[model samples]
Each structure stands twice: as structure tokens, then as C-alpha cells.
Target: GNEYPEDLAALPPQIIIGAQYVQAAGVALGFKKKGAKNVAYTYTGDGGTSQGDFYEGINFAGAYQAPAIFVVQNNGYAISVPRAVQTAAPTLAQKGLAAGIPGIQVDGMDALAVYLVMSEARKYSVEGNGPVLIETLTYRFGPHTLSGDDPHRYRTADEEAEWEKKDPLVRLRTYLDEKGLWSEEQEEAYIEEVNEQINEAMKKTEQAPKQKVSEYLQNVFVETPPTLEEQIAKFAAKEEA
Candidate 1:
């Protein structure tokens, strides 16, 4: 998550698909119990909407009227599978209707539109209302991952070029530039500043103390089991040598 210890809300990367939906619901309920105005927010792909946990999580939140925001990025493809084959739902946003929560769809490619919609969703959620489901209609430009999958096999060049025209960054940058709020010089300077910050972080990480296998084993349990204790001792001995 790269989140600071003091930060209460951070979306960590999880391997389990749609598991965080349940977690976000629980966190939102916790905030309500504490009488805090804070809301829990999480994102999932169109593919994750098919998971049982996704439905269960939204149902729970709706039942309790928990303040949560479920942002679904419908990028037209879930890995190599196209959206049509994934589910028969007319719109992913409508999936929340069964849970008795309001759902809204926004043009995800329009950065300003997304921002406005999210702002309204957050406001609705925090005002003693239940969770809101937001479906952002977007597109994936490349394969889900760099791992051997080829986009050319499933996606055509014409489709890729069409989505490229609607790229959010380019559209937003163009809008800002037209309004005299941005320029190529400013963008170049920002890029240079970000690179310098990255380099400084890398230097600090290089100077940090090396991690130990024994340290990991020792922290695994409050009272280490006999088998694990034996392994820890063996690793410790090797580290010392």
C-alpha cells in the first residue's frame, strides 16, 4: 500500500479478486459505529463484479446503510475475456440495484466528469445514506499484464486506436492547456521533479539495513510452535555464520 502508519485508510494491493469489497464494507461499518463521518472507498474491475464476495459485500453494506463507495472500472475486458462474455447485466452499475443502493454510470474517459460524479457519490454516502455503486465506462489500452498474453489476438488495431483518441490524460491535458492552465514546459518540469524524487527514494532504500530470514521467522507467531522454532533456530545459526 506504501501507506504511512498514521494513515487510517489505504487500499493495499490484494491478490484475491473482489475480497477488498467485503473489507471496505466492514471498514465503513466500523466508521459508522465510531460515529465518524469517514467513508470507505474501494475499486474493482468489471471482472470482479462477478465474484460472489462482491454481491455479498454490497448486500451487507446496503442492509446496514454503511457509508462506502464501490467504484467499478468497466474497461470492456477482464484479462483476455471480453465484457459481453463475462456477464449479461445491462450495466454493471445496475448490479447494485438488487442490494437496494443507488447506482450511477459516468463517462470514465472524461476526467472532469468522473471527478464530479465521485464527489456527489461521496457526499451521498457520508450523509447517513447507504453505499453507492459507480460504474466508470473505460477501456484498457493493453493486455492486463505483460505476462505472455497478446492484445492483438483479442483486440483489433482499429479498436485500440479509437480508445487512444479518448485517453483521459491526453484529453484532460488538452483541456487544461486550452484554458491556459498547463503547458509543455510545465509538464517537462513536473516529470523531471518526479524522477528526482524517485531517485532520492531509491538512494534511501539502498542505504537501509538488509532484511533477514531469521527476523521474518521470529515475527511469524506470538509463541512460535516447536516445528517453526526449530526452523527459526536453524536460520538464525546460518545468519550468524
Candidate 2:
């Protein structure tokens, strides 16, 4: 899912932390060179701002005046570490100042606000303005991952309850309902449609063939290295056995 093979414009995000920022700048520069109006955008957590690549990427984009957007989802935590512990910057958006790019912060919980901000940012960038840094004030409801994190360990239930009140889905649905645009029946039907689609996708996934260890090893190299050749042989032998 990290790699969207079907979408050519959707580059696979780098696994190395903060690497996508620089990649996006490069993509934006490529578009500019081709005289295209397209802009490149990438996202990272508040914690990712600490990485050296973040500064380098933004700085490069700034100096070259490449059309790019860097979004920081300041969910208040980077895994187990709180945002306060990450940096002393008054606001993450201000980090763009050092790179000579425009920076702004918006209410991450309000979907409409985010949409408006992104619209303006896209317009600014595509119109020859360099990169923009946007910090979205948000919160995480559950563990960073379902694996080892426990929100209760670091954040208070009171804080969680406060954020739950600002849930974007809830706010958006309320606004739609107020405008007489959404109804319970429509919501129910949409939910059923989504459930069916998810079920079908899961069924297809369950029926997919399993990949072998040998296949993974072989795919890693075009001309297999001697070390990998030995590994492939050992795994293939074990698998055949």
C-alpha cells in the first residue's frame, strides 16, 4: 500500500525518515523544468521535522524556488515522545522561515479549514511561489501503532476526551447535516457500500498466492551477488525439502 503501483504520479514514499521531503522538491523541480503547472507535496509527522533531511529538502526547494508543499501533521506525539520534547521551536510552521519559505498553521480538526488552506497553498506554489510549510494541530486517538504503544502511558484521558470533541468526521457530518445535505439513510447506505468493498478486497487478498523466501531473495538483485546466490540456494533447498 505504501507503493501505489497504479498511480504513476504517486511516488513511493521513502522508508528513511524525512527523505520524502527532498524527493518531493526534486519532483517539483522536474515539473518546473518541463514547464508544467504541477506541484509536488509530501507529509510527515511533527517528529520528522527533527531529521536533517527535512531542513536540507526545504532549503533546496527554497533556494531553487521549486513548487512544493510540506505538511507536518503535528499530532502532538512522535511515537512515544511528546512534541514539546522534540524541539523548542514556538511553532513548527516557523521552521520554514529559516529556509526563506512561507509558513502557516491551521486547525487540523476542521476539515473545511484544512481544505481552504491547501487550496491557497497549492495556488501559491503553482503560481511560481516556492515551497510552503504547513503545521496541522491534531491529536492521535489511539496508539502510534497497534503494536507496542499505549496512549494512556503518556497522555491523559482528559486530553483524549478533548480531542475526541474535535474529531473531523464528527464536525464535518454535523455541518453537512445542518446544511440539509446529509441524512442518516445516506450515511447507512454509504457505510454498507464501503463494507461490501472492503469485504471484496479482503476476499481477494485471502485468495492471493503466498510469496516464497527465494522469490524475495532473487528479486533483491538483478545479477545476484555470490552471497545472495548462496542464500537463495539454501532457502530454495529448504523450501523444496
Predicted model with the maximum TM-score: 1
lDDT of 2 at 165: 98
lDDT of 2 by residue, 1-241 (tens): 1222222253443478798898888877777676677778899999899899899999999999998999999999998898999999989999999999998999999999999999899999989988899999999889988898888999999999999999999999999999999999999999999999999999998997776777666544449999999998999999899
Provide the lowest-lDDT 10-residue window in model 1. 1-10
> What's the C-alpha lDDT at position 141 in model 2?
82
What Cα-based lDDT does every candidate model obtain?
0.87, 0.87
The C-alpha stretches of model 2 lying farther than 4 A from their native spots are: 1-12, 192-241
Alpha carbon lDDT at 52, candidate 2: 91
Judged by whole-model lDDT over C-alpha atoms, candidate 2 comes out at: 0.87
Off by over 4 Å in 1: 1-13, 196-241
What's model 1's lDDT at 200? 100
